[model samples]
Target: MTAPEPAEPPAAEPGVTAAEPAAAGPDSAARPGAEPAEPTDADAASHSAALPGADLDGADLDGADLDGADLDGAEPAGALPTERAAAGVPGKRGRRRVAPAPEPAPVLDDAELRGALEAILLVVDEPVSELTLAQVLEQPAERIGPALDRIAAGYTAAGHGFELRRAAGGWRLYTRPEYATYVERFVLDGQSVRLTQAALETLAVIAYKQPVTRSRISAIRGVNCDGVIRTLVSRGLVEECGTEADSGAFLYRTTTLFLEKLGLNSVADLPPLAPFLPDDVEELADATR
Candidate 1:
């Protein structure tokens, strides 16, 4: 009696069982208060497809504010703008725009071009070539020739004192030939200046044997002509042309002014030296020249 069986272990509560875990099932992990499961690949892909620009691979939209974009099947906000696409920047699929070629320089009209040519010709000292004038005026060479022709015609029609002529292989301004008498008289001023005997001889030698060197002239005259040549040069009768190829000495020649004073068009107009020299000397002088 005193060691009667210990009271039977208290019975579990009516709704409770032995302390054991419940059987796990698919729904067990998805209880009402439980955290949701991570999405599967299929579900993630479908969701992404529903978002704008999701199909555009490598598109970056981190800084974009897409609030204004249409959410119902509209183009992606991540696409390049149409303007940028058309400018040949990669992507967005548009015709590339090309800048128009630079417009050609406007051609000047005849009157305007001729006026410019006249202005340039007035200030130039040496003859100006057609190519040079074309470069300066920014006109075509063909146009320059026609413009020069018109300018020359206008000057002629106006009877201007100066005329444009092609000389020394280029265009230059020259006093009309008809005005030469008046020009000569004005230059000489009714004074008869004469060259000394030595200067005259030197000038004659230089005229016939043009482009001759001082040493050659000395050899021919049997005396030094350096002084006489200097005198002639100072009088504007002769000028240094270039060096003799064989002697490397300075070569002298008569000048345009010299022809002007002699009333000749060119050196070829000089009279023959036959009458002024002995028969033998004449042949020798002609042969020397």
Candidate 2:
């Protein structure tokens, strides 16, 4: 029998090229019928790995019309909350930024120190400690202490109407005792100088019997003195001392303001009450009997 020659492939169109068949494996091509080999890691990855334009997060982009992601390696405008935390937000970069401390004030000369201390003293409502003054003025504690002493000494030497005094563990400005009459007249502004009689009595009781309970004070006075005691306390004349051991009542005592008002060094300076009492002790005893 004569052998027939194989027919050639059909001609491609003018602009259209013929599609090429996929190259089969060498063994598969050699064998008449063979199953194809399984896809490799590289082949599986190529399916996802080389998408037209893909991001590190595995999200893709087809064109400019693609939605909700930055083309460059930047955070998208609409990011998930979990992603926003690390999305280059200013001042929230997962690290603390501590502001630098303010610089200390320049050291002051003697005249400058005195002026500064006087300025602070004028504005102060209560006694300010030396440590506080040193911190505020940025001077050494030793220097501040001696400077304060010198300032006090200068006031005393000059016989100024006001003196720098240390009391209650701190320094304060005070009107000298001799000049207090003028200061009182100025501050009173037509108000009376005397404390109320009840207040005076409560104060006297507290001064004489220091750390006495309110009940004991009432017992001695034969009246309810809660209001008077409160008034004395409000006036800074009396303050709470330790509570009574047995009764557990808050005990009252005189204050620094009280001593200052009376110009006394301590409660011991309070005059003896017996000397000021009425002289007819025998008649009073006879009447009581």
Candidate 3:
């Protein structure tokens, strides 16, 4: 009924017996006296015990390849003994590696702290808030606030007119009240430090319209400020440091002295000027006059 019962499966050739699995001899089979060919905790201990001149302490071979040889269940190339371990020193067992002692907590030297505080005051036109300073330096505000106080006292003791002071949400350098008049007179008379109307206007625009381009300034002022800008450039009152990505336009900004002239420590210290309007254009003209 079945289709001729597929021809009787071919019989084996004479003496060509199916290969029998090689019989595992005593030596090939796992035995109590033989080191377990596979790694086991006990075999690992035994192989490690047999290691010559191998130190276990400080020596680490976890995950080492043994190629199916357990060396008495000791991992192949198991952590060898170290001299320290051999000498009974303690070992770090089962402990994962840790990073080195976090770079000694970065203690700032006195000069570094002092210089940083001074630089902060020099760049800031308004008092730099402790939080802001901390953010800039990537330090804790609490630490920076105290450091600022120390810097202030140092400046005062040295009779420096400008000292660190906090107000309006930041720390700033300001002249001592006692030196205000004298400082004013000096600035007014100093040939190198004279302020001009054009400089003032440019400074105002930069302060108010920061990160602005020359074209924007020209548009707002309704006159070409190229000459005024040049003058300011000559006086070191403004600088062109970079071009805007949009249109590759040149941008301008006020310099530190702009803050100095107004006795201000930061642009934040600048008084909010009244917004100029078409109707106020007349007033601006008269004021310029």
Candidate 4:
């Protein structure tokens, strides 16, 4: 068996060149007389609109008017005033301007301050604290102390019927010691008026152990002192200071009236409790002092 001869090459049609390839379709690259079609503005715009952030290096965009383009997702150049303020942006006109707080009143001179202090003192029935005076006078406590000392000295030098005295952790005016006899005669008027023994004892305990509670006073006296304490309070001898920290009970202290009656300038001037106490209990007086 012999191999069939290779099939004869297809015959070239008439009027067709043999060296040229077959005619290509309209979409083919090698078609004769075919120039790549230049994209129109409409086509370019449609392509750009389809792909976001697409490169358009060779695209002709001159006739592609973007006036009607949808740019809803684009960031604006500046934020609105309310938005800027909410975001706390610096150097923005939307920021609030806060007005400064008012300053306190100016301090008065020594003479004015003294006069103001005297006016307040004259009206107050109870002894006034240095701190209270300072607050009302709008001056420092240090300055108030000096002014008070000056006032006290002036009263003493002038031999006023009343003297400024510090007592019960405060300052108050009291009749001079020399005038006490006359005051007592006028007030008593031959009436037999005196504190009971129990009241006297309760007052002594309060004078020594100030800021003591009724419960503690009862324990010290070995008897319930509630009645006696009430009597002393009514007589203007003892007064409630504040509550105790641990026990939360009302604490009492002696008043200026107690000092005047005892002829004592302050609680510190009271005679030593050690001498009157038993030998074994004398050491406890040191704690009270």
Q: After aligning candidate 2 to the native by TM-score, how far in Å is the CA of 125 from where it should be?
A: 3.3
- The lDDT-based order of candidates, best leading, equals 4, 2, 1, 3
Worst 10-residue lDDT window for candidate 2 reads: 88-97
Task: Note the residue pairs that clash in candidate 1.
Answer: none
What's the TM for model 4? 0.51
Tens digit per residue, CA lDDT, model 1, 171-246: 7677888997898799899987778888888898999999899998998888999999988998888999989888
- Which lDDT tens digits does candidate 3 get at residues 1-289? 6676557877768755443233576666444444323355765687878989776856557886645442442322345556434544333442224437755346567688678778767876555578877677666667887788888888889998677766545667787989877988888775555567766777678778887888888877777888888888888768886999978988898776565545565677777665544767778778866
lDDT of 4 at 38: 57
Poorest stretch of ten by lDDT in candidate 3: 89-98
In angstroms, the error of model 4 at 266 is 6.6
Better of 2 and 3 by TM-score: 2
Clashes of 2: 0
Weakest ten-residue segment in model 1 by summed lDDT = 87-96
Report the C-alpha lDDT of model 4 over 58-155, residue by residue, as the tens digit.
Answer: 86878876664545433345777566446655332333446489998798998898898788878878777899988876778898888989999999
For candidate 2, write residues 158-259 as lDDT tens digits.
988888877655788888889878888899988986888988888898899998999989987879999999988888889998888897899999998887
TM-score of 2: 0.52
User: What count of clashes does model 3 give?
Assistant: 20
- How far does residue 227 in candidate 2 sit from its true spot (Å)? 6.6
Most TM-score-accurate candidate: 2
Off by over 4 Å in 4: 1-93, 185-193, 209-230, 233-269, 275-289
Q: Hey, what RMSD does candidate 2 come out at?
A: 10.6
